[model samples]
Target: MTDNSAERRREKQPRTGAEQPWEPEDLVISEGKDPTPERLEEARRRLADEGPSAIERSAP
Candidate 1:
């Protein structure tokens, strides 16, 4: 069998930081509820103003 342990280890490693810049889509406004346009816009604005902290601030 091919040894894939290294790949598995890499996958299990914690991310050093965000792979890409935060986007409005990254926000989780509610559990089952889909975010509205206004909420998305708010997330966009928050991302611009607060950076990644916006995600924490907007989390349910």
Candidate 2:
């Protein structure tokens, strides 16, 4: 390429060339409970505060 620094920067990006068609309706997660907006918000908060271990805390 014209500039080595520009090529390096492009390589460090998080997104890849191939990706799925992103859609909000496709996200349907349930922890054995009804998919309510409040429950989803609580789960998000728990995950952010507790990290990956939060998933295990949910009852099957």
Candidate 3:
């Protein structure tokens, strides 16, 4: 190997799909609700503003 830091940096770059995929349980289901785009937006908004606990509270 050459004594070049730039070449080492390029070699250590992440591959595709290096992270774990979510399971079915990763999806939070609410009663009488479908997993639609609107719901997804709302969840995202809640999560962004107030985080996971607020999302759980506001979801159902």
User: Which candidate has the top score in lDDT?
Assistant: 1
Q: What C-alpha lDDT values do all the predictions have?
A: 0.66, 0.50, 0.49
lDDT of 1 by residue, 1-60 (tens): 999999999999876344447667667442234678877887778778888666654454
lDDT-best of 2 and 3: 2
Q: Estimate each model's TM-score.
A: 0.49, 0.44, 0.39
The digit string of per-residue lDDT tens for model 3 on 1-60 reads 568898889779764321333222222343245667776666566555655455345333
Best-first order by TM-score: 1, 2, 3
Give candidate 3's total backbone clashes.
Answer: 0
Local lDDT at 32 for model 2: 58
Most accurate candidate by TM-score: 1
